[model samples]
Target: MPKVSRIIPILENLLFFWLGLALVLSLAGDSLNIPSLLQVLGRAHPLILHFPIVLLLMAVAMLWIKDEKIKEIGTWVLLLGANLTGLTVLAGLLLANEDYDGAMLFWHQWLGVASLGLSVLIYFYRDKSSSFLKISTGALAVAIVLTGHFGADLTHGENFLLTPIQSNEEEFVALDDAEVFQHMVKPILEAKCISCHKEGKVKGELRMDDLAGLQKGGKNGPFVVPGDLKESLLIQRIHLPEDSKEHMPPKNKAQLTDEELEILQLWVESGSSFEQKVTELESEEPLFQLASNKFSNQKSYTFDAASDSDISELNNFFRKVNPVFPGSPALEVAYYGTSAFDPTSLKDLKSIKEQVVKMNLNRMPLESVDLSFLRDFQNLEELQMNFTGVTPNQLSNLEGLENLRNLAISGNSLGAEAVSVLEKLTQVKKIFLWNSGLDESSKENLRKALTTAHIDFGFDGKGIIYALNPPKITFDKELFQDSMELVLSHPIRTAEIRYTLDGTEPDSISSPVYTAPIWLKKTAQIRAKAFAADWTGSLTVSDLLFKSGIQPESYRLAFEPNTKYKAKGAASLFDGIKGKTGHGSGNWLGFKDTSMELEIFIAENTSPNEISISLLLNEIAYIFPPENVEIWTGNQQGWQKLPNTDNAQSTKIEEVRFGMLTFPLPETDFDKVKIRLRPISKLPAWHPGAGAKGWVFVDEILLN
Candidate 1:
């Protein structure tokens, strides 16, 4: 008998032929009623199609068998695959012939017929070892595949094969804008916000990433008062133009999402003062039962559990509260425990198994815990089995933990096998393992395995020791003064990282710091820590922010030229094209006077820092880029650049950050000059092609 695979290649060849014919039919505008005909045969095209697919797939599997000598037996199996596949192709061709179509189905018909022909040709060569025969067979095989794929696409959408990826992406645990802020939003803000807004050295004077943070809007004044979104200075800054000086996120930082904004709004309007969140959810029953107290309705919850405690605690929790699920009790429960882990107990908990929304077995030994009990906990939202004896094998019973959102397996003997059980529970986002025996590779692999949810592991009992960020020294902007504001912020939840500016660790006696945003400034050091008992210390970024002193008046007292130079005027040091780059020293174009209408180029000599100049075009109208313009002197030395997307129009000024340009006049110091230049968009020279067009042309003379 021919080996299974020997038959498979032949069958697969026939299958591809059919597949190709299908594609050509669809493409050629065939109104193929083949599917309808197959349906009439009681084996629709969808059904008839499966046989060829299975046979071809079986043929490939037969080929993959490694035992060559014994594989001969499998070779015959391939022949069977081929025969079945041929049957499939015949049926498919018969069905295709039923479709009558216009030009649209013309190619579809040909593609199918051609595929069938190619499959027949390939089948004839399956037994031949001749290279030419093999090559010819291979070419036919490729065409067959291309035909099949296009056929499927015609039946399905362009992403039919990749629908899983899109579905997975779309199915992440969705948190609304409000809930999003509670989790994702608050974490980012508390991590990066708060500084430069708390106290005296306040830059914008806005301190809250919290309710208070919102209430105390920064320099622009109270961002959000009670119930006032429009009046909120905080929201105002968020809405500022990205390049506007009032932009709130400061420089190089991610912005808050609208969802986070909504959370802030809701909390503010209601005077949100809740600090601890998880604990609040713990007692949500009170709010759930407060209004539904129709005492006459005596409700009972029935669950299946091996243990009574699982039901006992649940009953106690729901003792005073009966959740109304539609018309019945809203709560459902289930439990699974064995005599080893208390099998009788697991069984008893099963009585009210449907109402078991939350089950706390923290630190309880589940060595023999009925692993399959998870199937009963369909309503289980929060399962605390931390410190339980869970291993890799028994964890598979948790495949039914689809509703399990929070699972703490900290300090368990759980290993790779246990984490594998997690793939089925895509909804489970957070599985905490503090001091768990999880290795780095397993954790990373689990991360890849669970794309929808985040997994976290922390050292046991070793909570994060806080590290306080240094205060912003806001004196004369960029210059540190004795009165600069020092700032420190910490995680709003639980933390305290030791920090210091005197280059020392902050001790409790060293002025215990609160987690709130603090403001102060000096050469003095600062730091923080978790101070809680048995907490893991956090790393600190020492000297995070050095207080800035007041910068002195930096404008050089020199004569600058004006525009509209008499093109014939002799040129001076300040009256010609200038270009510069680098950090060595002050390279300037000295102008004895701006009287001469000569053009001078005063450029930045490649300094990484801002290189700006006040172009005095008192003589005539001067042209330069608009976006990069800056004010002369004071704290207005900030540089701005236009987005590269905007091309420099004929009227647009050419601003280059890679270098600079200046044409100071020595012939005439004109009256009223527009300081029409700021530093260019300073991106790295090696950065991807962007912000590159930095040439500024000034004609060296213009008319006002």
Candidate 2:
């Protein structure tokens, strides 16, 4: 839809024309009574008001001659007013059935109806026959203008139609956030809340779990106020649209019931203060070790409000299931350290009625335990035997581990032939066989059988394994020509180096390989590629690493013509660039291959005003659309963007900055610019074509 200004006036014009015609017929003295007539126009009030306000305004703009469609719309509105005002009068008859007392309202209604009826008459005929319709429509409009004045009087005391909105800041409150946090609100936060807030687990940053913590507020904010609930931060949250960031009791947590909130409000009104602690008091009921698992306080939480009994039950239960690393990966397998495992503790642990989902026997005495006893743990989900004397066959007793999802047997003496038997238990999702006595082929076979399960080491392979790339140099600081040298030493001396200077070719003979560091200062790249023979040097194994050199201390900047620097009288600049080429995504080209010095300057005269440049240096040339380039001076408050234009170059670039996007650009009155480089990239999942597509070249900034 067009803006409101563009649509309102047309509706206004059409409405007045119809009203004038209705009045002419009434003055000419027809049997159509004024009340009935006004009622008729009043009926059209709702349906016809939006038309002139919107359509006539558009007609005014049409005089500028920009849009071709408005003339047709004007013609349509003229026809619409004629039909609607006729209908408005018909509806007024129905409304007339209701008795109205106010004369202003009575006259406004009847006059509108009478005027609309005359509008129809003028639309059909007039004193002059040839121009009858035109004269009649004009008369109808004049009648509406007179009626509008009266309606305005009834609605806004005569001048409501011509006033602007008032904006006075003093009408609002002016309280500091910290002040609202302290004495005014802390009292409502009682001891029943602290379990999750006391120490390490301040979830939601709201430690209402305690009074002191509540005053400090978490990621949310201070939770109370004095004398006023509307102005309080806590009140704001409680009233938030449940799922909103400002929503209190922020989803998934218990909310303060009506009664609890009333107490809190009462406390706040009574000059919000902290509740005092009385340590001497004792309760009849003693807090015991939790006898359950679900609400274990081991997993911390900071509830806005929860009962004391709820907190106690959850805390006791967690301290038990927490057997070392409860939620995280178990670090202390009994066999690894005696402190982590006590035989007596294990003896009592085995007698527990609860199911054991995980069992570790790395340094533990699982071999001595009756294998038959292990069968009782039907709920076992994971079992680890890292570095143990037990063979793969020893776990045959755990064959029916219906819930066993993972098995770790790394650093063991189990071979592939024995590991295969466990593969039949399809429930296993992962098997860690790192550093075990298993054949690589056997591991591959087991992996294939258990397509969904990942087997790492067992039956994997024997011997040293390494990857062969196009080629890579084992050196430090290839870019900027740092002192680090490339050492082309391999597992064996049968390989030679052959590389290219230009980044295009990965072929051999590009450069001579040696045992020393190569140094140079120019625009050139070297690929320390490796070539080896299988006893006979007819064909070479492929491997390569490219290194490019740059002189950061000495670089030049230049600008191209036809480049747009600013987005027309805006605070932001513009750089319309397509994709520049270099390594993107999984393909990583060193910084040496993609480096450039960029310089931006203000254009002397242009259709658009001022512009500036801000860019970051990144190791890659990856650019994707919806792409943003951010630039900032270290001392500035924030960075800005280079808005897109018709020119593709003005829309995208290879730099990254933060804080606010869609920001305006810097001024164009600077001489020497110094900025650090930062960059980012969109991965394949974020973009199609694997995000490996874009151009990344650099030069001086340009303006159109």
Best by TM-score: 2
TM-score, prediction 2: 0.32
The per-model lDDT (C-alpha) reads 0.43, 0.42
Model 1 ranges off by over 4 Å: 1-341, 460-466, 469-704
> How do the residues 1-704 of candidate 1 rate in per-residue lDDT, one tens digit apiece?
46854856656665566555545544552344445555464235446555544554444444445567534543454445445544554454454444222232244335545544544554555456546444644554564565566445434323345666664532122211113235433544554454333221134444443466564555556755654444555444553323335555664555555444444544444433444232222223332132123122333335432344443464533222234344443344323342334444555555555666666666556776666866786777667677778776666766676667777677887766666776666877677877767788888888888986657677533454543333222223221334454444544345454445443566645646554444554323344443444444444433322333222212222334222222222232223332221100122222212211221222232111122232221100112233343222111343332223331322322211121222222222222223343213332243221233222222222111
**How many clashes (backbone atoms < 3 Å, residues ≥3 apart in a chain or on different chains) does model 1 have?**
157
lDDT of 1 at 128: 65
